[model samples]
Target chain A: EADIYQTPRYLVIGTGKKITLECSQTMGHDKMYWYQQDPGMELHLIHYSYGVNSTEKGDLSSESTVSRIRTEHFPLTLESARPSHTSQYLCASSEGQGRNTEAFFGQGTRLTVV
Target chain B: QQPVQSPQAVILREGEDAVINCSSSKALYSVHWYRQKHGEAPVFLMILLKGGEQKGHEKISASFNEKKQQSSLYLTASQLSYSGTYFCGTEMRGGGSQGNLIFGKGTKLSVKP
Candidate 1:
């Protein structure tokens, strides 16, 4: 199994509540990413970080934000959750520049907002 | 942009063979293949860089045609363990330094006994 890990494998929160999905990797990878996936749909990149203090938005516009203060930790936060935010959140990390590197994914966190 | 995957889904029996194709409009730096089981994280199978390279993993193999900007995954003698949703992720050349991949909608594969 990959060393990457996502906290709160499953989360249930009321709408308007704040939540943070945690992702950490022990491999010390320089690239970290957060993706949102729905049933029978493609995984959409929401946020990613190349390294500490370097973050970028993905192709898909998202309401959530991410911070990479540490190489091993990249966390996604939503100030206020909504029904539309309910989805499976996956975290991944890749070594080196990412061009030829294969990404290792975490187990993912399934969030439900009501 | 996301690549286009053909045959949104496929079903095959053990010992059968199948092919999944992914096409992109942009120039690709590399193409990665992954498989995800129901309610599980995707597992990387292989990566094919430019120059129309081909790589194999066990009974699975993949070929990238840089000229056509397309890649194909081949599964020979499919086994029940190969049953899962197959995804093709493309890394466009100009995407940026981060090199994040843009994934296709996915192709569901079912291998029965």
Candidate 2:
């Protein structure tokens, strides 16, 4: 099915190491977003993009950053991973139509900073 | 801003009905419902637009109130498969710029057969 995909479904890394979580979609949706969540907790928006070449910070201040070099690709990178950054990262995309335009989510990447 | 979901968690018996409520502080253009099982991604349930509109599939449905900034999800004849955490996300009028939906903490529903 045409959907969003995230790589390395699970990641365990050491502190101070750099890592990038990959997110890609084949839907050609113009808007993409990244959300962080602890188990069974509220999802916090970390980063988002309106389209290719456009990226912005979300409501939650994140130590990681994202890049939208292509319309289908929006990858998040942490300069230096920390234990505080350990959480499940979810990637989603939306179409700017209808009052109820719902976003589609990826399987998510669970990062454990050891 | 993040929306608030009521009845943080609920336990139901199979074939029973349950209601989950979500309220936002700001005016909502639309509201979305999703369900997440243990160790799984959230799956779309339904989306209710403004102006007292509603939409649903199967036994799950939802309603949206633009004025009150509230939305409710109704699950009828619940099944064991309905056991999951439900979340409501709200989109505001001027929020299209960010293309992001503020999500509620989520309501955990356990359906015992």
CA-lDDT, candidates in order: 0.89, 0.87
What are the per-residue Cα lDDT tens digits for candidate 1 across A35-76? 999976899988888889989999899999999999999999
List fnat, each candidate: 0.82, 0.71
Indicate the residue-level lDDT of A48 in model 1.
82
lDDT, residue B44, model 1: 92
DockQ of 1: 0.84
lDDT (tens digit, per residue) of candidate 2 on B51-85? 65666566787877777888889999999999999
- The DockQ values of the predictions, listed in order, are 0.84, 0.71
Clashing pairs in 2: none
Q: Which regions of candidate 2 deviate over 4 angstroms?
A: A97-100, B52-55, B95-98
lDDT of residue A5 for candidate 1: 97
RMSD of each: 1.5, 1.7
Q: For model 2 chain A, give the 10-residue run with minimal summed lDDT.
A: A94-103
User: What lDDT tens digits, residue by residue, belong to model 1 across residues B21-90?
Assistant: 9999988889999999998999999889887554547667888999999999999989899999999998
Model 1, residue B28: distance off in Å is: 0.9
